[model samples]
Target: MKKTILITGAGTGIGKDAAFALALRGHRVLATTQTEAQSDVLRIEATNRNVVLEIFKLDITLEADREAIAAYPIDVLLNNAGMGESGSLAEVDMQRVRQIFEVNLFATLALTQVALRGMIAREKGTVLFVSSIAGRVPMPFLMPYSMSKFALSAAGAGLRAEMDQLKKNIQIALIEPGAIHTGFNQAMTNSKYQWMNASSYFAHQAEAMKKKERATFKFLEARSTQGIVNQIVKAAEASRPKLRYVSPWIQGFGIRLARIFGV
Candidate 1:
């Protein structure tokens, strides 16, 4: 059956690809980007593929954006928009940490709240939260982003139990993707480099950190975005979808193995 799906952060990365792919599958797709420029690019890219993708401006930070989404009869809410910021937990800038949470955690929950109400009324809908592998395993230097995703994982689990209690046909799912070649890694490196450069005491540590970041990026460039998108679509469309969908077999398998062996 065809469904109406709304995807956030469809301007780029996995969200962008998923929006187009879902549209190709004959579902009505509403793709939201943070900026007008991105909406324009999405419009052009989607038009060529005979995909019925409509682009809208939605900065999840704004109440107006959430209201705009409420106007649509959405069947699946793909909470794919997020931001990344990195720093050591001890001396990280509080403002940057708050800003990351504003986008990644707080705003995501607010938007989900809006979607949940609509889904509850109809008693049928699916919510897909695009979390990260960092949510599952601790990683160094990205405390803010990692913590936000970890919170989302918690929210997903709690929300699933609530849905069961309410007897709502609404499904709550999570996409815990491993590293993909999104601009997120580059942005993380740049933000940390700038922050460290501006600080007197952190310059030497920042230099060493940049070397490791370079290596990380080189290793991640080989990863595929398609697998993440596939898992997301499956989460949205499957009748009996798993509560959590982790992607790129190697990373997903390795993480599960680590959990099993307590490694």
Candidate 2:
């Protein structure tokens, strides 16, 4: 059935792809970007590709933008706007760590609560969180961001159960994508270099760490986002969606293995 869906961070990456995919499937998609420029670019891209969706600017971190979602009577809320930070806990800026939580968790959770108000009032709706496999497995140098996702994963699970107990037909799901070549992961690791230096404890192996980071994504990051977007679409439409929807089954399996081995 066609539904009104609202997606954050829809100008790029998996969010952008999923917006187009969902809209092409005949869903009413309100695809929001972080900036007006992004919205403009998305408009052009959508027109060029003949994708149907309403593009707008919405920074989830901002109250005004978040309020706009409530006006839409949305049937599905896709939380995809998030930031990433990387650095050793001891060396990484504490402020950066806090900021990571602000964007990746606090804002997301708050927005979920907002969306829930409408959903709960109607007693029907779906909330899909775009979390990461990093939430399940510990990746070095990416601890701060991972920490946020850990909380996010927990939030989604707990909220899902909470709504279930209320006997509401509300559905909640987490879309965990691992190492997709969205340039976001690259920026995540690279962000560390901006503040990291020889004085840092890991200074001795800084270059090596950088090389390993690049190699990690180069080898693991999927070249295309088709599979990732497919999972998003699946979660969006599933009547009784699973708790977690992970893309690139192999990567998901790797996460399971790491958890089993206590990695």
Candidate 3:
């Protein structure tokens, strides 16, 4: 079945890869980026790759940009646009934490509500939230990002049950991607250094923390986005998608074990 899917953060990383993959699978993909420059680049890349994608600029946090979603009768809304910040929660700036929540949670839910209006009228649609494995566990410096995803994951599950109770054909699913070798993870992990200084707590351990993060990624991060992309495609195409789709099965398994053993 050919469906129209709207994906946020389609300018790079997993989102970009998923957009191209879906388009190649014969679905109409509306790939939106945060800036016009990114949209232009994506357009060119899509052309070069011979993939048909409707590339556009859509900053999810902006009201006007979110309003644009109503213009298209979308079959699926993939909330993949997110930002990250890292620091000890005790010392981190509160504004940074708020900003992450504004993008990762509030704006995402707002857009979901906008899309839901149309989906409810049509009596059918799907919503996928791209959460993180960090959401499942406590990440020391990555708490800000992890907190947002945790809230998002919880909201996604709750919404799914609500929609079921309403008897609407709308489906809600979560896409939990583990550390993929996309620059995203590195950038997020390095974010804390921007604010940390000689006076800050844990300043002395900075180098050690950086080394550990790098080593962890080297050994645990998946080298390709294909694992998560495959899960996204499956959820998008399935008539009754699972409540959650986790990629790089091994990482998901590890998380489950950690939770079971109280790690």
lDDT of 2 at 85: 92
Candidate ranking under TM-score, highest first, comes to 3, 2, 1
Q: Between prediction 2 and prediction 3, which has the larger TM-score?
A: 3
Candidates' C-alpha lDDT: 0.85, 0.91, 0.95
lDDT of 2 by residue, 55-162 (tens): 999988898888777887888999999888999988787899989898999988888888888999998999999999999987788999999998899999999999
Residue pairs in candidate 1 whose N, alpha carbon or C atoms collide under 3 angstroms: none
Best-fitting candidate, scored by TM-score: 3
Model 3 lDDT per residue over 52-80, tens place: 99999999999999999999999999999
- lDDT score for candidate 3 against the true structure: 0.95
Model 2 segments more than 4 A misplaced? none
TM-score of 2: 0.98
Overall local distance difference test of candidate 1: 0.85
Where does model 3 exceed 4 Å of error? none
The local lDDT score (0 to 100) that residue 86 gets in candidate 1 is 83
